[model samples]
Target chain A: MKQEHIQQIGAAVAAVAEKNRINHFYFVACGGSQAFMMPAQYLFDREIETPASIYSSNEFVHRVPKALGQDSVVITCSHSGNTPETVKATEFAREKGATTIALSNVEDSPLWKAAEYPIHYDWGKEADASDLNKGVLYYLIFSVLHAVSPREKYRKGMEAVAGLNDAIEKVKTQYAGIVKEWGKQYKREKLIYTMGSGANYGEAYSFAICLLMEMQWIHSNAIHSGEYFHGPFEVTDYDVPFIMIKGIGATRPLDERAYDFCRKYSEKLMVVDEMEFDMTGIDDQVREYFAPLLAGAVLRSLADEFAYQRGHDLSVRRYMWRMEY
Target chain B: MKQEHIQQIGAAVAAVAEKNRINHFYFVACGGSQAFMMPAQYLFDREIETPASIYSSNEFVHRVPKALGQDSVVITCSHSGNTPETVKATEFAREKGATTIALSNVEDSPLWKAAEYPIHYDWGKEADASDLNKGVLYYLIFSVLHAVSPREKYRKGMEAVAGLNDAIEKVKTQYAGIVKEWGKQYKREKLIYTMGSGANYGEAYSFAICLLMEMQWIHSNAIHSGEYFHGPFEVTDYDVPFIMIKGIGATRPLDERAYDFCRKYSEKLMVVDEMEFDMTGIDDQVREYFAPLLAGAVLRSLADEFAYQRGHDLSVRRYMWRMEY
Candidate 1:
């Protein structure tokens, strides 16, 4: 991965913050862009006036009213930069006189052209690095956004991302072993339910989509861990795999509750707990910020390995129609 | 069925608005309360900048760090008004020196007592109304809210509710007919999918919940109309009931797309389409808005009649739980 691509992301975010002094930020994108924005949105919402609303471009336009204005900076994220809704929204906001920033892997994508000051990720050459490349781009953008937003937050995010990088190798090794061993058990599973809380909820949905659409080619539902109680929990059978994602911090108790319930009710159960990491040296406050990201990043790695081991063709696009939007 | 009860609801809302001179309004509630808030929220989001955010009481503390402040006025809705998180949140906000208004049916419920101002819909003598009572209470609360909020939209709301009342009657008659004819077909179905957009999306969920927990002991899902395209549309076999809510207005186009697609792909498709009575002299806009309220109000009648026709014991609560703070 190009270190320069990461630096550029950080710089662009910093510049936007300096120019707009964005007290309220709205990150508008869809799919992976929305997923990557979740962690930063949570952090920002915790410190400032509600983490900026993250909207899938179409959702922003159709349901949510005019949230962006002169005081707001809208960030449109797209890997290819040609996402129709995002580009349309960028132009729409510009028409209404709102500032815009585009974040993308391709420099000349339509998103970059539509933006006032587009930041290029240009990590196209390192797409093979997969999660590492995508994660770093988001981390750098988040770092700059933190600096621009509740400026008090920049250092904490920097420290958290750095600590995440340090834990990367161990996370990769641990996940590799787990995926290789347990993935076979998923073959006969009738349905898979992936559940998580906070920042990891998006990741759980991503896993649900990939498993049902890409790996198992079966029906899957990803739910907010708490929401399982409302109805879907009753549908669990002995043949279904209940996957619970457990991270660290205050929300850990809720995930623990979900895990306990899954163990009691689901005959086939799996848990990915991140408490094994020795983040005790890190302050509890910083640990709170890093926990979900590290845990989800690790879980994502395991899911990727599991998909490959199960003979799911990573090169093939099973849900190609997702691109029709 | 008591005209006095309906009048009281309208009067209560007007009184609250006049007393507060409320230029802004906030609605906080979870689950059923949140579901009930959907229609009013869409109306407010369209006409005013009084930004509305919905949160589960437990989540309000964590999710809405900076969304609430001293200058703002909050309205918390709970059917029982005893939901733990909402009560605790009301207390927390009061301690933080913010104003709160609670709306509930129970007279002395914790949430009702905790608010700086509380509006209680004591249909104590009229429990038979069930969900219809909730609608009347909402009509009252929205009228009061619109009168006081920045938009002073009470007149428009009263007019809207009156239109809804007319629609409700027509819907009752038509729904009775639909349930007598179609309710028998639903008995053998294992999976039911409810889909809609905007305000109707929330209604779709309520319908699914009623079908599973109240009407039939079956598995059901309420999906946003747009999201069906993501994956669930592939599951449209003869075994599934693809119920689409086709209301008019902003979400009309999206719902139409779903209706058209379902008609082609699914063998068992049911649609509740917008219908209007002859108001030939009325303005086109009024006629337009009238169509949706007419269509949606009728679903209430259909839901109740369907339950009865299916030989489903509406009195036996399959899912029952207590809310604790």
Candidate 2:
């Protein structure tokens, strides 16, 4: 997380935008990293007229979109920079004549080698890698998109990115006590359901899968608020545990409906509304678009609290990094 | 599930193809029905050169793709034919001048009224609704794709669809005992992890969310086999129950990697390989394409066993249809 890294990514994005009439932007990565880039994808969808997609690395390799070509740009990430599927996908994008960009902590890794442009940033083990990457991606993606569509809103949004660190700090301080209490109360729960809509969907999903299930070994399922009414709502009971991330957006009504119902039915309902956070200096009109980032920052603190309360090390894993899958 | 129904769907698909030159095909639905159409989406991706996309109903409404237009065909499904989102989406597609097709068990439902071509079938309440919808969707999707692409493989595949009932029956009979044993063994477990890749991913996801989690009130998380190694694999332990569906396809290697890793780490690994079932009369080249349907047929029996073992009626629910959200 350095200013030089941000400048480097901005330069690379501008170069790609100048060189090609980009028809598509694809964000490809493995689980946590892919989830990390989802906010960028949502930004592209909501702000830029150009089409953008987020794909799991393995799926992208198997079904390379027909739209991918010389006019396309593919952004991929791997913190270790040697994740096999991501490296392979970056290579494939290059082979297809699409401009490939790689983001990673390791500069000498295979993913870095495969990219036309590699943005290397060293966020130490203590730092939240996803948050740092999200900051970088917002600058990179919005800059490229702004180059294409030339929107004033895009310029304003980029300016707001500089204040994100301060905004996240305020959010963490405000939610620390509540998060800790939640961690202690739900530490022994066997399973929990998480829900979010629009941009916040990715944060809800990654928090459930990566942090809760993967890091803590606690069972959790993330349900899209829009789809919750269809089937997942049937699982709700007076004692069922539920975590909802309410964000400000066009899809806020969808989340609201779920919240209203859960509050009546489930006694163990926890809602982390982005509106509760003070995102100072960010425009109210564009505040909803930043919900994913804000929610991610707050959820990291909750994950930490859960680790502390449950006496489990977040980095301790039985399989990941310990063995070859 | 009937030959006349297949012929009727084929005729409707041909009519749609004849009326408009479809540049894109979009399959949209909610929950289990959305899962039912994934195989069709896969078929369109693998066979036809035209772009195809699968989307959750709510997401499709929020971000209607720029590619959707007079030349686009949108297919949606809802078993009750009253799913508010799907009905609303079909109306939106019609307003956008895209050809809308609806599949449902209720012929007079709002979804049916909104569709340009409504394909309704009365699969009895006792029958597996998803399996029946899969059978109908296969004919509708392949016929439309074949009309555009004119591939001999598609013709041969259509011919094999005639024998699906027998193929499914064989799979059900073979897996019944094993499914029952699994139900009994894992019935007491608080949470289960399910994994599948390629075409079988939908079945794995739907079985976990729509069946185990929703209908039976059990906790389950479906992990894409390719994504399992990315982060979810960290949760693996000696007692963590896992259900892996191994399908035959280009992505089989992804599942194999996960299966190999889980075998070494977790004691509770249950793999349901499609190769174990006899898909009689299906051509070797097309058998892999039918993995989703085959997996769905087998998993239906497993869901039934779980319902019986848990002493929970499949129709029982705390919310969904029990109370308005």
Candidate 3:
């Protein structure tokens, strides 16, 4: 968000690249944090020769990758900085001689203590557009991208991300009416399915798990557009509630195909199309990668509206952090 | 399968390796076929240096990998050998100069025509355990592993697979009573959720989608066990129906934790523990990898029993091959 934050991320990435060969990148965390890394992983797969993967914190620890050594970077996030497995994962990565970077809302938290580079990203309503957790993730992703391949376009991408708040604000106001309309429709939903493909699939997953299932206590599952035709499509009927995220990416066609099929069958189909979003600052070359960020913003607003319509607090969780597993 | 089938797979893999420098592998298919490739993808991640990825057939075509070139191998499957996307993906890979392999139930089908190597595998009731599509996949996977980095133990793993029919048959007998009981409980159920981790996750997904959703038109989703703790755990309730597949892989503990927690919350929790299955011929070292194959057999049996209990024919489908998407 801020130039200073961008500089800090760049410097951190540069230091890691200087210290390690950095041939592989791993993004490990739990829940929403893990889902948040999907876009970045997709970026790495498309943009760099070095491999990158996202994993649940426990899986990263239990099935420790042989490739995760001195030449690797492991980035983990925990909003509370006290997610046990995430802290353990950061420690495990550090023990394996990998560069560990952690993002949490609390500074010097348990996760921070375990990481070599600790970043505190903003969360909750007070956090402005530029300093949101997604913003920090964009900065970290592009900073790592610059460190790995030093692409001029990637640097431009970071510049776009640096000045996106104005654009983000405009889109939120534009989406408010639709959000209210959809919130009313979704208020009584007992089961809703979110579908998308490519990087946007992460947004769908977050919407399904974090917003619908966790926040509203609704039954939901994130269905990959590419996978919808397989077995999932068979569940389609007139009464099915489906929310589809349509991205303007290479995988857009996959989403379109699924969207086309679903609209014909399901009456309660809501779509959040990236084409409607105003990503004014993002360059044409990398707009597809940032599409998820835009859609995520709209979905977050929709989540808020849904919360209002249902009279449910997004923070009200039956299990998470409330009970020991 | 016949020893010749193993020899044939070995020869094909050897030829590909000798002709090209294979640095990556891609498995592309649709639906059940796509889910089927996940375990082999896991195998490649754990056992080989060359990275392997599984993709829904369309995603493979739409998001064509930059890594897929002369040094890559693409394996695509379409059981009917007529899946349009599967054919196109194989052709795309071959056009990119990657060695392409196609597995189909029908020989000389379109997908086979597009591939550099074409192999047919048995399917349905008449097919023996050793000649099933899964058996063909195992042969192809191990063959590639042998060609990539030959190991005596891996060869032994193959030898174990070579004569696993009696072991598979034995497990079926042991699992029969439980499958019928589960069928009776699951017959009237309209929704089911499956969870598992590591290679065995493919089994969980296949059970959820192919067996439940597509076959019985039940609403179901496969949740990754490692991911179960994050947001999915909040959805667990006393009446929630869960089919958790417990594997003996590196991520088995993740499954165990989810299983333990689910048992406390969900009264309708059914488990197929790999520990309870008979893997008589599969060596201890490789048993974890084969757990999915064993679990898959049991689930397939469970699917059959469910269908009988519900008076729903497993072959009946509302869309697949019956309607155009």
Query: Top lDDT: which candidate number?
Result: 3
Worst 10 residues of 1 chain A by lDDT: A124-133
lDDT digits (tens) for residues B31-134 of candidate 1: 55655666665655555554555555555554555656664566677778877767887887767656676677787788878987666554443343322435
The candidate that wins on DockQ is 3
The TM-score values for the models, in the order shown, are 0.83, 0.93, 0.97
lDDT (10s digit) by residue, model 2, range A1-325: 4666766787677778687477678899998889888777776766654667788898788865767779888999999999999999999999999989999978879999999889876574455432367667776766776777777777777766677777877888898889888988888886778899888888988988899878988778788887787777877888888889988876777888889988988899888997788978776666887767878877888889888888898988877777666
Instruction: Judging by lDDT, tell me the better candidate of 1 and 2.
Output: 2
**RMSD in angstroms between candidate 1 and the native structure over all alpha carbons:** 4.5
TM-score result, candidate 1: 0.83
Candidate 2 lDDT tens digits, B129-164 = 323676677767767767776777877677777777
- Candidate 1 chain B lowest-lDDT run of ten: B316-325
* lDDT of each candidate versus the true structure: 0.60, 0.80, 0.83
Give the Cα error of residue B186 in candidate 3, in Å. Answer: 2.3
Instruction: Return whichever of 1 and 3 wins on DockQ.
Output: 3
- Superior by TM-score: candidate 1 or candidate 3: 3
Taking the tens digit of each residue's C-alpha lDDT, what string does model 3 give over B192-300?
Answer: 8999988887888888878888888888878889888888888899988999999999998999999999999999988988898778778887888877887888888
Write down the TM-score of model 3's second chain. Answer: 0.96
